[model samples]
Structures are given as structure tokens and as C-alpha cells.
Target: MILGHTIKDYKRENLLHDVITGIIIMAVSIPISMGYSQIAGLPAVYGLYGSVFPIILFALFSTSPQFIFGVDAAPAALVGSALLGMNIQSGSKEALAVVPVITFFVALWLLAFYLMHAGKLVNYISAPVMGGFITGICSTIILMQVPKLMGGTAGTGELLELLEHIEKTAEQINLPSLILGILSLVVLLAAKKIMPKFPMAVVMMAAGAVLTQVLPMKEWGIKTLDAVAPGLPKWSFPNLMLIPMDEVVTISLSVAVVIMAETLLAENNFAQKNGYRINDNQELLAFAVGNLVAALTGCCPINGSVSRTAMGEQYQGKTQLMSIVAGLSMILLLLFGTGFIGYLPVPVLTAIVISALLGATEFELAVKLWKVSRTECFIFWGAFIGVLLLGTINGVLIGIILSFAEMVIRSSKPASCFLGIQPGHKHFRDLAESRQIHEIEGVLIYRFSSNLFFANAGVLQQDIEQELERRGNIKAVILDASGIGSMDITAADRIEILYKSLKEQGIRFYITEHIADLNEQMRKLGIGYLIEEGCVRRTIYIALKDMGIKRPYPLEGGVDNEERSASRKRVDNRMQEFVWAFGSDTEDQIERQIAQQIKQLKQNGDVEKLLHGSWSHMEAFDEDEWLEHLEEHLKEIVNISGKDERTLAARFEEHRREIHERIMKEHPELAQRFKERRHRLDEHLKERRPEVYDLVVSLRELEKRKDME
Candidate 1:
């Protein structure tokens, strides 16, 4: 559980990618580890030493598949500051003696954290906070490296120190170093588009080394890394004599906590981005082993290196094998390729590091938040700015606080709408977004779009009250409880108060369109009276019907904001029940069926057969109504088919006998129903539509004469 999870499904195709990624990581690690090493008050080579063993140990033990582990900024800076606080000189012999002991104690604290399951703390940090924290870290480190690209040493500390360092470096202006770094950055950045899988970071690094060898290094005064002494990292016990036990324990615990917090958050952030799972407890175990290796190698306390890990991910590293290969590659460099490190230009290396960090920054996340939710955007920037001004831990804290505040604000003022019944839709919709939707006469339907909790109960009540005031003659108020999944005591009590108030005003109050489970929830919350009093119904339609309100539920002043055409409204008026069922789509539905029926008529020369067989009219409860709907489209049907009205009438008369025969053959009940209740709608059709009425009457009379013969 603590290791080799990625290897269980190790992909063979990814071997070369991981190997090349390992080489690239080792190359990038040279400058970063050295920079952090100096910050931790150790010699540059110790950073390299720390990289080899700790990474290998992490690969063996870490549940994280691709997260690169080694010396990182937070723990290194903590160690360096601890040395300063204790009045010990940095990079001195006494400092060297004390640092490993500190690392050893840090490892012990991590072991304790593992036992306590402290890694679960990451579960509370939101995605926006994690993304912003990562972006801030990447930006800060990139700013630190910008000075090196302009011919100065890598800057330390926060945004202010980095800006100051860049300004100072700009003042001196090493022309050759600046040009080389910029060109290198251009190449690395350009490679991603031109050849994404080309391993350009390594190619640029090798080219930088070859440039230093071929070109004059001292003449141009280009900064390159110092030559590392060829030796393997020795397993040595820490000498604790240089610091008091109490001070060491205090400082080491602080270092360990920062390492654990910063690294675990970054690691889990990566895990989330890549769509994998991490066992938080086992991740702590990995941290313990990695730092123990750091202690044995006489290096600063180790943590997950976000900069290096981001670089590895950019190059498409897969599996823990990337970590093993990186460790092995570092070992090979220390033993045999140590002299080659002297020829690699700092400007070119810095450019590569800066470019990699640029890719890692979450600019897209910030922009998306800006577009969709302004409050979330504020939370993101809060974390990003906090990291630059303060540190990683404080940055995460600031974002979390902002997220909680936003949640509270949103819950207190959740979405609510006064709904109007659109003619064609079974469910009501928001009045603002609808056309030809009617608010029922003396009836108000309200919807609240979040769970009814203590914070948002007033919002629900307020929305209903405003609508009731606006329409003073309201007889019934319907709460569409579809959006209210459950309610708390405050909300339940608020509802009771609302019902009493509405009753006092002679308006009936009802709750409908919620799950049956919600009724049980209301009962448990002491609002069961709403249910017992027949105020809770299964649907808004039933609730209105029970209140003596019926179809086309007459609106306050006809259809409010009636956008339907006059001709279309006439069609709707003729088919009021159909419009009530199918809404605005009724005309289109009828026209399409008539179009389909004409095609069938052209082929079969049958009118009655087409009507009975049409799947579109299958939902009609009454055959008379279905025929009436068809008759409405019959004039267009005649014109589109190039048929005379008299000829179509003759066909209808002739098909009436075939309809009887077809019905007797297939279903006797349909024949009996047709005989019993035929021509029922024709009575109204004569008054409303004389042309259709006359045509239908002539057709039926012609059929009757033929039957008498």
C-alpha cells in the first residue's frame, strides 16, 4: 500500500519517456538543488547527494507515481533560518554538523505524523486553493530564477526580494549572459509547440554544456555550476554536539511540519490534476523514508519538489521508475560526469527552469473562475497573492478562509425564482426566461433553488412575500418544493409561520412537487401539520385542481407577456386541451404529422388508415379529438399534395368504409367506439370553422348515401 502501485500496471510504451524524463530531471535538478542547498547552509554538492538517495527511497516507498522528491524550498529555508536564529553561521562546519541531526529529528516527527494520519488535512483544501497555491509557488520560483538568467545568483525569499534582485541584476546587465538565457528560454518554450515529445529541455541543457566547452567561458564571464567532487553519498550518523537537544527538537519539529504540510498539499494537488488516488497515510510513510535517506546522506531535510515534479510531468514521465531513473542518473553524474557540470551555463539552466515553471502555473484556472464566478476568482487571487507576500502555509490559509466566507455568503442568499406556468411545459419555469408563460389567476407558485437551511430560510420566505404583495388578490400560494431537498428546524418553523400568515390573509398555502422522503423530513422537523392538513400534494397540477383551479388556469390578465403570434394563438384556442398538454410545440407537432400523412396518402390513397396508424396521435385519449386535430391540418394537406378539396373529401368518404372493415379485422372495440361517438367534435367545428365543417358534413353525407344504396 505504501509503494509500487503505479508499477502494478507499468506500461512498457512509457519506458523510453520515463528514461528521457529522468535525464532531463537530473539536468534541471543540478541548478535547483544547488540553489536550495546554499539556502539550507550546505555546500552545492550535498544537494546533489540529497537528490540521489532520497529520490530512490521515495520511488520505493511513495504511493505517488510521478511526484519527484528531493530538496525543496520551504524545508531548506526553514533549516537556514533555524541556523540564523541559533546564531550559527551558514555553510560553516558547525552548521553542517547540526543540520543532519535536525533532518533526523524531522524524520521522527514525520513518522509520528504518519501514525496520527495528519495527511487527511488535505481533504479540506478546495481545488481553487490548491491550484492558486501551486501557481503562486511556480511564479515565485520563476521570479527567483529570473535574476540568474540576467547574470546574477538565484534570489531567495518572497516576491519583494525577488523583484529587488531582478532590479539589481538589471543594473549590472551582463549582455552575453542575458542574450544566452533569453535565447535558451525561447528555444525551450518554442519546442513545446514544434515538437512536444522531443525532450527539448535535455537537448537545450546539453547544448548549453557544449556551448560553454566550445566557446570561451572566462572571457565572456558566463556563470556556470562549480565542478562537483566525484564520490558517492556516504551513510553517516548525525553529530548532534553543535546544537542543544531542546533547540534542535523545537526547530526540527517546525521544519518537519512545514515539509509535511507544503509537500503533501502539492502532491495531492498533482494527484487530483492527473486523476489518480493517493493513500494519505502511506504518503506520510514515504515522507518519513525519504527524509531518513536525506539525513543519512548528510543533506538538508527533503520534501516533494514541486518545481522538479512539474518539470517531470511536463516531459510526460510515468510510473515510479522515473524517480528511480532520476536517482540513478544523478549517481552516474556524481561519479563520472562531475567535471561536465562546470561547463553548463547558469543563464541557460535558469531559462529552462523558468520555462518549466511557467507551464506549471495555473493561469487557465484563474481565468475560468473569473468568467464563471467572480467570488471564486477573488479566493484564487487571495491564495496567489498570499503566497507571494507571505509563505505557502499562510497562502493556503488565506484561500481556505476566503472559500469558507464565500460558502457562507452564497448559502445565505441562494437562488430563488417566481415561476410562471408556460402553456406547453408540465413544470413551471422562471418568469424572466420564459415567453407566453402565464401566472395563474389569484395563485402564486414559488421555487427556492437550494436546500432549506437556517442560513437561506429567510431568502425563501422573502421571495414568496414579495410576490404575494405584488399580486394582492392571490387566493392560493404554491411552494414548488422540487428544489428543496430537505429542511432544517429554522426552515420548517419559517414555513409554519408563512402558512399562518397566508391563512390570516385568506390565502390558502400549499407545498407540492417534492419527494415523499421530504414529507418524512418535514414530519421529523415538527412541520407535519402541513402534510396532515392536505396542504402537501404530489404535484402542482393536483394542488391547483384541488383548489378548484382547472386547465388553462386563467391568468391574472390573460397570458402575461404573450409572445405567441395571433394566428398561432387562434390555433391554440381551437385546440386548448392540446396546447395545455403539448405547450408551444403543438402546432409544429400537428403540421409534421400532416406532412407525414400526406406522404403516406400519396402512396396508399388512404385517409382513415393513416389517421388511426399515426404514432404521433397515439397519446390522444379521445378519437374525436385526434380527428379534429387532423381536420385542422387538412386544408394544408390538400394544398401541399396538389389535390382538390372535393377529391380529398371523396377519398375521406370512401375511406370511412375501409376504416370500418380494417377496425373489424384488427380491433372490434375501435369500430364500436367510432360508431358510438363519431362526429362529436363536428358540432363545434361548424360554428368555429365553417369551411372544415361544410367539407366534413358533405363527406359524411356522401358516405351515408353510399351505405343506403
Candidate 2:
């Protein structure tokens, strides 16, 4: 009972600490949220609304307890533009009323995605593409705000057209506003560089507010917040029936998807860095509910703000305490701090926005992107131009569409190659690199280094056709399936078409070494049995041999094992005791047995006879020098007797495999080479076996045929 009480007290104490941390995060969030609201062209009160009930609601249901969900710059700018289209301004009741409605619809869209578990869909927007889009957006924001910061009448138009007008009126720019703007930019940039932890936005806002008290900003025609309404949270709603429901519905859906995607990404990223988990579905619901609240009052589209979340994390905030505390802090500010904010200058707000934009911009990635992928860089620039000319929503749409188009383009041209192993090298390399290996006649081994999917299906077909065209005598085409990772229905259809087309051309098609996943996919599509499964050489060799194609390397001179007399053949004397089975006690024990056998063979002069007579049996001829070295060091095969050279060679290979397996099984820490040698020897023994027919003679015939051409 005492222990239980102590545990309960500990939990309570931790909860209190979490609550305290939440309060500090909220304290920091309020000022930033207000500043961001100005960026959205909304009243300062809207910022409070953003950090209040919506935050609390998100805290209740959001996956990330630490993620401070509130009004952010991106959504605010988007909402402000949307309101302008509806002939509404920031402080107007009409714009304020619609803010929550837009937010609600956006939340609904996010909820749909979460329910569908569309987290993986975020992969479509590659990092390079996002980097470009962010840079473009930042550039646009800076340019758009420059005229306002200079206190100049930059005629309202599209972003690019407005920029052109601003350029023309540079001489008429107000000196005081320009100075203020420049100072703000410098301070914001400096703050980020020198004291990243300090709230530069707030500091700049304070400076601008103080400057307004002494300077006659209105005399200079400088704009300011001017007025603020102080009150507790209130209920409100946008007139959905009166507004253009169709436009609202469509635009709201698009905005919602973007907000959800960005928010979920931000939440997941922060959660991972901080060692927590994010539930996409719960976040969707939370934001959806919050947006409903925003729409009821006078708030614009709101999403999880990355800046505020970062602040919360920096302050070591955990759980919903931070968001709740931040909300309460906002309530206190609303009751006391409304009048002071009205003195804040537009130039300072511009500085804050600019700083936020600069922070959001991925300058490093922008530089790397140019060198990394020109195609993706092009899409980002293209989208930037589109958005600067058309609008934000259109620009993002074009960027996404272009991204999809790029995928199609890459799939249209897959990489194809002919492969072979270099002479005296075990690695299978491209035939282009290892030109010394003679091409087996009437056979071509092609490897498709991509998935057999719809995008590259036609490309695969064209490559196959090209191979056939190049080699008219090609009777067999073996697909090296080692690289093919996947296949789709369209790819399957194309393969079926190719199979029939080749069959008509008197050529047999085969697939070799396909991975299990692809093999299963083929089986599921009912075409597994159509293609033979094995190594490219084995499959092609067997197929050609069956089709009357001559073997490249047939057994030449000794009596065939199949035809040899039983008396002439060495006895399997230890067959009853299963002599092939080596002891599992240790690697040293099995190695000692093999060494003894090799020594006996050497002392008996069997090694000397083989060295003098057979090139293949010589010590230098052995591909694995370790085996030959061990043979020289050993005394005799005492346990198993009378093993001929053929049997001994086979046993030696087996011994190597056994020793490798023992090292891997028992001495796992020895070296990486133990695993490599084990695998190599296993593959060699499994793949390289003597064929009954001569293949060299067939190659000679094929060479003559090619020479005739």
C-alpha cells in the first residue's frame, strides 16, 4: 500500500512538471502566433484564437502531445489570398467569419487522408522538389513584403506583375519605411545567426512598437496594426450558404490536403527526433475539430505550426500541458496585452515574416539540389514560376503533376545490359567490361536492372527486340532476373506478349534467379510455370541443349562416370557409416582430418604425379590456395582410405564448405571472409558441374556461322 502510494505520487509529480513546461511553451507561442496572424492579414485577436481552443482540442486528440498546433504562416498566407478572392479584408467580419469554415474543410480533408492511412503518399513529394518549392515561396514572400516594408504604393497585382511595378517605383520608396524594413531584415537575420534560441520576431516587434511611439509613422504614411479588440473567446461562423459554396468546397479541399500533409510531416519529424510516436489519424481528427472551432469564430485556416512546435521542444515541453498552458497564457494576454500590440509597425511584422520565411527556406538543400537532380530542380523552378504568375494553389498542383510525369519518363527508358564473368574472376560483371569472355553462340543473357512494371514495360519489350535484331542466330534469350525487383499487371501482360512473339520467331525465352517476391507475383498471375527458374547459364544451357543446341564444354576424355565399371569406380566403403558427414565438434577437428588426408596423398607421391601430369590438379591450378596449402601441410587420410583424386577433390570442396559453416556457426567473430568464402564455395559446387556433352564444339560452329555473316 505504501509503495503504491509512492508510485502514484511520482506520477503526479511528473504530470506537474509537464504542466509547468507546457506553460512556458504557451508563453512563447502566444507572441509568435500573433505575429504570424498579421502575416495572414488577419487581426491580432485571430492569433489568440489560433492558440486557444483549437490548441486545446488538438491536445485532446493529437498524436504528438508536444506538437503545439496553432495558426502558422503558410496557412495564414493561403487563407488571406483566399479571402481577397472573396472581396474580404483581414479585419472585416466577413473574412473573419469564413476563416474557421476554410479551416474546418481543410481539417475534414486531412481526416479523410488519415483514415485511409495515406502516410506513404507523402513520398510522392520528394525532398528536392519540396526544397525548390520552399525556396520559391520564400522568394515570393520576401518580394511581396518589400514594397510594404518600404512604405511605398506597389500597385496590387499578381506577384510577378506587382514585382515589376515595385521595380519601377523604387525611386519613390519612403526612406523611413525602407530604413525600418532594412533594419528589420538585418536584425532578424542577425538574430538567427547569433542567437537562434532568442525570439527575433518578438524582439523586432517590440523594437517597431517602441519606434512608433516616438516617430510620427502616420506622417510618413507608414501602416501599423492601429487597433485591437480585447476579449475572452467568442463564438462565430462563416455564412457557408451565402458564400460561393462550390469554389469554397474545392479550394478548401485542396488547402486541407496540403495542410494535413505538411502538419503530419512536421509532427512525425519532430516526434522521431524527440523519441515519440505520431498518430496521423488522431492528428487529423484533432485538427478537424479545431478547424470547426476556428470557423465558428473569426480565424483563418490553421495547421500545426513547425516554429511553435520547435519552441515547445526547445523548452523541454512534454504532453498536452504545454499547449494547454499556452492557451491559458493567451487568455491572460487577451485580458491585458491587446492595446500594446496595436502600436506594432507593419515593417516589423514584415521583418518577422521575412525571418520566418528565411528560416523555413532550405538554402543548403537548394544548392545541393542543382548538383543532385536537374530534373527535379526544373520542376521546382517551373512550379515557382507558375505560382508567382498564377497563384500558390496552382503552382503546387503543377509541381505535383510534373513530379508524376517525371516518374513516367524514367520508366519509359529502363537500363538493360548483357553480363558475363571475367576470366579468372568469380564476380559476374557486365559483358561490356569483361570483353575477354567469348560469347556463347545462339544464346544471349540479358539483365533488366529495374522492376517489370507498367512504366518500363514497353522499354523492356524494345530492349528484347533490339537483342534479337543484333543476334539473328539467337535461339535462346535468358532474362537475368537477379535485378528485377517487382512486376505489375501491365508488365505481366507485356511479358506474355513478348513470350508469344519470341515463340513465333523460333526463339525460346527463359527467366533465371528471380527473387522470391517476384516469383510469387508471377505465380499469382498464373505465369510462374511458363518460365524456367535457375541460374542464367544453367537455364540457357539446359534449354539450348534440349533444343538441339550444342554444349559449350562437354566431358572430353575419360570413361564417363555413368559408363564406368563398378570395380573401376572407387568403393563407397564408408557409405554405411555416412563418411560424408564431418564432425561438428569444432572447425579445428574437421580441418585436422582434411589436413591428414592431404598429407598422406602428398607423402604417397599422388600430389607429385598430379602436379606433373594434370594442369587442373596442380597446386597452382587450385582456385582456393588455402585448400592446396592445407593439403601440403597434412599427413594422410587415416579414417577414410583409398579415396581417388576425383573423390578427394570432391571431398576437399566439401571440407571447405564444412569448415566455412563451422566458422560461421561457432566462430562468428573471426572475419567477414569466412562468410564470403563459405557462400562462394557453396555457389561454385552448386553451379559448376561437368556437363555430359561438349559445348566447345558447338561454340566453334556458332563462330563459323557468325564469320559467314
Candidate 3:
């Protein structure tokens, strides 16, 4: 972890506190590690040994400040699965010898992962999947031990088979073991509930010991673990010749993936909780060392333990000293306190494991998931089932795959809608749903609602091309990029191609305000400089103003009537085309609807009919009347959207004013004719309010220019 070497606030008093915290963590970890060893099908003493030197080494060299590195349930279960798979008898010398080799393999795998920088790969595992998987693992771990907790020996197999066996033989459950299991489970649960800072596992173990001595369960047919041999760890080297190369490599690969994931998770989580920043590479190295120690010291593969780290946090342990203390405590237990450990009941260990797994399920995360999406909740549950039924690896993989599939589906069908200005407001919105706005002529503005990435680059290019093709007269195309934040190389190349295509066609290509990083990248590609500098508008308002397009003012004289008339006509034309092309679910129905509106308008008095008519019902109308009403009541539509006509008018003027001024200046001799035309334009705008005219005119102008070329 990024626990900086700079000691900004170290104190002697805090050091003492760390020591006290370490001792408590050590005391708690000792019993747990010993118990975990039993879970691994190893002698309890090896668990105790595994917790010692490895913990000390990791504490000193590990990145996380407060992470308590030691033997964990995941690695233990993995080891047991490997041993069983290899047909190695649990207590055989060969089984014992294979562990070191496995540990060495796990360590190397971790080192490789670190070198490859695969830490961020976990981000692809969606939150829902993780929640489901962890919860499932917790439930599975609990269920798997139910038989043992009740004092019965059952061989592992498929989850369903094991569960079926337990259910079929419920009556065979030993009453003494059941009572012990229930008692230990209850104590551990209660300790966590009432005093979480206290070592609940240790307390439960002590309770188990007390119950064992006071009412010896063995006499009553309750099973107990045999006495474990206690000693300092002896170095063990793998006998390469004794093991087949294929078996060793296969087992190593499997164990490595499991251990690497487990340790990296623990190290990162611990560092995050303790305000330390973890270096993924450094963490892998530390785990590599930890694994090496576990191998040579006659123990199963070790990984980061979330439970032990939580214990450290609860007890205010925030230094490697905690790990040292915990390690030393285990050594002392081995050297002189071995007899005391024998008194601990097997049920108590099972209780501790179950309870810890329950805590690790991340209940709070599920609550948060509910707020994100119901689909995510479904994913979570699916992964949870996968973990429970299929095991951790398979379950996690399923979740990841499902999440990725969801992303691809969404991106493949990203949202695209016509950009319409609020009826009287400056802000643009989706034309289909909003009553307030109209699509502008000579300007095709669109916003793509997802990242421009390799997966969706083709879609983006097609969508843009289709929009431009539909409005072939567009003078400027502004891409509203607020929704987009990232782009892949393919997407960048596609954008460059579109830019050059637009430029060749004399249609200015512009990107509006976008993410800074994307803007820089586009600039680096020289698209920024190649395009018209003024055309690269930062916002919708700026783009419209720069283009000199303006909305007509009612009963106002300052505005140029002809220009407003032309603009209104263009807007009407686009609306008609949009409605014709992609607006309605059915073309025949839309045509019928339009016909009905025209018939109704002819039959009713203007104010009376419109005042009472529902907008959706009145959608069908003659183009002339529809355009006139749209322009006249544009303010009303905009007002409903909480904006006014002036804002929209100002934006429109920003785009069209320059061209208007230039035209007037260029033809001084026709000033009088222009003035008369402006009045005629005003009269026409109020009466016609044509939707398709402006779009048609813009397209005609482009066609005329192309003919000149």
C-alpha cells in the first residue's frame, strides 16, 4: 500500500497503541488460523505455523498498513479441492510434500499478475455480480460445514449431492456436536453484535474450551480433533522427481489464480479502509514472499485474510506491528501453549468460519445496489446463486460475462433523438417528447449518449451520416458532446473521416463543449485546427449565435422580417420531413393523422378549436396552418418548459445575424428593396410559419453551390 515513508504525525504514544492493538489481533488470529488449517485438511499445528513468520514478513514488507496477512478460508478450500482432485490422501506424506510446490506456484502466479498489471481488470466485474458472488460464497461456506458442525464426517462432492446427503441423514446428527455448534455460533454472533471490537472468534473458542472441560463431549460420542504436533517450522523443498510435471503445473496454475485474486482483494481492501493507497505490483510481490514462506514452512498456500484484517481494524491495529504480535503469539502457542489449543472444540471453529463468512457477504452493498437498478439486483442474485452452486471461480466468471453482455447490448442501441430548441427557450431538447422546441434549418445538431468506443464507433458513424444525409443542405453540423467522455482509436479515426467528408462537402463539422481529455485528443489529431475555428462552438447557444439564426419577434420592428420568414419556413420544412421519416410508428397512420388535422382546422373556428383541442389529437394538420401556429405559440410551448421566447430568439440570432448583415452590406443598392422584402417576410412569417421551407432552401443553396463547382 502507499503508506508513505514520510512520517508526518508519528508519536511514541501511538506506537504503544499499535502494539496493544497488535497483541489483540495476534490473540484472535492464532485460534482462527489453527481452525482454518483443519478446514484445509492439514494438521492444526501447520495453520498455527503458517500464521507466524509469513505474517511477520508481510507485515514488514506488505503495502497495506493494517492488513493482517495470514491463512484464509478461500485458499484453504482451494488447497483441499486440489488435494482431492490429485487423488492425494489427506494425511499422506506426498500430500504434505505437494503443498510446498503448490505454494511456490501460487507465489509465482501472483508475481506474474503484478508484473502484468492486471489489478484494474477487477473493475470489469460489475457490482451486482460481485454482491451476488460474495453472498453466495458465504451461504455455500456455511452450508458446506453444516455436517461437520453437527459432528458427522462427509466427503465433499457436488454441492447438490452434499446437501442431499445432509438432508437425507438429518437424524444422524450428533446432539452434543449440534449443541456445541449452536452455542459457539450464538456466542460468536452475540460477541459481534454486542461488542464488535472484542475478538469474537477467540471468545467463542474459549467458550468451546470451557464447554469441553466441564462436559467432555468425547465421552458422549462427540468427535474432537486429535492433538497437533507443535514446533517451529522446518524448511521443506519440493521433490520435483516424485511429482509428474503435468500434475504439478496444472495444480499450480489453478492455485495461483485463486491465491492472486484473494491476496490482491485483501490488500486493496485493507489499504482502502486504513487510508493507505495500495500498489498492486507491490502487493503481488508481498504475497509472493508470503507464499514462499508458507511453502518452506510446511503449510498450505497462504493469502490475505479479510477476517483477520477486520479484526485488526476493530482493535485499532494500524501498523505491521499488529502482524508481528499476532505471529509471535502463534509461536508462543506452538512452543508452550499447544496443550491449551487442544481444548478448543471443532464446532467452535466451524462457527467462527460461518460467522466470518456471513460478515463478508457485504449486506450493506445489497441495499445500495437496489438504488442503482433492478437489473443490477437481478445480476447480484444470479451471481450469488452461481457462487453457491458452482463455486467461487465459476460464479464470479458468470457475473462478469453477464455484466459485459449488458454493456454491449446498451451500447449497440444507444439513444439518438432530433435536437429541438425549446419552443421559446434557448436550451435544446429531444423534439419527439418536448412540446417546446423546433429543429433548426441549416444546422444539424445531435448528441450521442454513449462513449465513442470501438464497440460502438460504427454505429456512431452511421447515425451521423444518416442525419446529415436526411438534411443534405446543412451548413454546419454541431455534435453535442457533453454525454461522451471517452473514445477509442477506431472512434477517433471515424470522427476524422467524418470531419474531412463534411469539409469536402462545404458543411462545417464542429464539436461542442466536451470532456477536456477528449478535447485534447481531438486537438492532437489536428481536427481542431483543420475545422473552422469559429465553427467549433462550445455550447448550443454559441453555435446558434455564431451561425446568425434568430427567431421572429411578435409585434416587434427591430427584427428583419424576410430573414425571420426564411428561418421560420426552413424550420417548418425540417419538421415535415422529420415527421414523415422517423416521427411516427407507421407512415400510413401519420398521413391519416395529418389529414384529419387539416380537415378539423377547416371545420372549426381558429381560437375555439385550438383552445379546446388536445395537442396530441391536433398533431395532424395542413403544413401552412401547422407552421403558423407553431411559430405563434412557440413562446407558450417554451413557457411550459420554464423558458421564454427571448432566450431562444437570442440563440437563433447568434447564428444567422452575420450572414444577414453581410448580405445587406454586399447589396447596398438594393437596400430599399431589401427593406420592403423584410416587411413582406414579417407578414409571411406570421401567416405561414413554414416548417419545411427553410430546410428546403438550405438544401437548394447547397445544391446550387455544388452546381457552380
| Candidate with best lDDT | 1
Q: Which of 1 and 2 is ahead in TM-score?
A: 1
Q: Give each model a TM-score.
A: 0.70, 0.63, 0.66
Evaluate residue 66 in candidate 2 and report its C-alpha lDDT on the 0 to 100 scale.
Answer: 71
The candidate, 1 or 3, that scores higher on TM-score is: 1
Model 2, 1-709: lDDT tens per residue? 1223323454554465455555545544554566557656677667877778888777767767677788765677677777778777766766666666776677667667667877666556655455555555556656665676777532333576767867865867777777887888898788767876555555666677788899898898777764557887678555666556787778788678767766765566556556776656667777777777776666767777765665454434556666766777777767887777578777767666556656655567646667887787777676667656765556666777888888778766777787543333333356786446434456677778777788888887888798779767777777877768888988888888888798898887877645545655775676654622211122333334445543222221221212233233222111111111112222343344445545556567454332222111111112243453343322243223455534445445555445546545544454365545545644543343322012222433565797799
Model 3, 287-358: lDDT tens digits are 778888888887888877766665566556666766777788878877887777667677767666667666
Q: Write down the lDDT that model 2 would get.
A: 0.60
Each prediction's RMSD to truth: 16.7, 16.5, 17.5
For each candidate, the alpha-carbon lDDT, in order, equals: 0.80, 0.60, 0.63
What value does the lDDT take at residue 70 in candidate 3? 81
C-alpha lDDT of candidate 1 relative to the true structure: 0.80
lDDT of 1 at 252: 87
Candidate 1 versus truth, CA RMSD in Å, comes to 16.7
Off by over 4 Å in 3: 1-42, 84-87, 153-158, 161-165, 168-171, 199-201, 266-276, 310-319, 410-442, 454-476, 485-509, 514-709
- Which candidate comes out best when scored by TM-score? 1
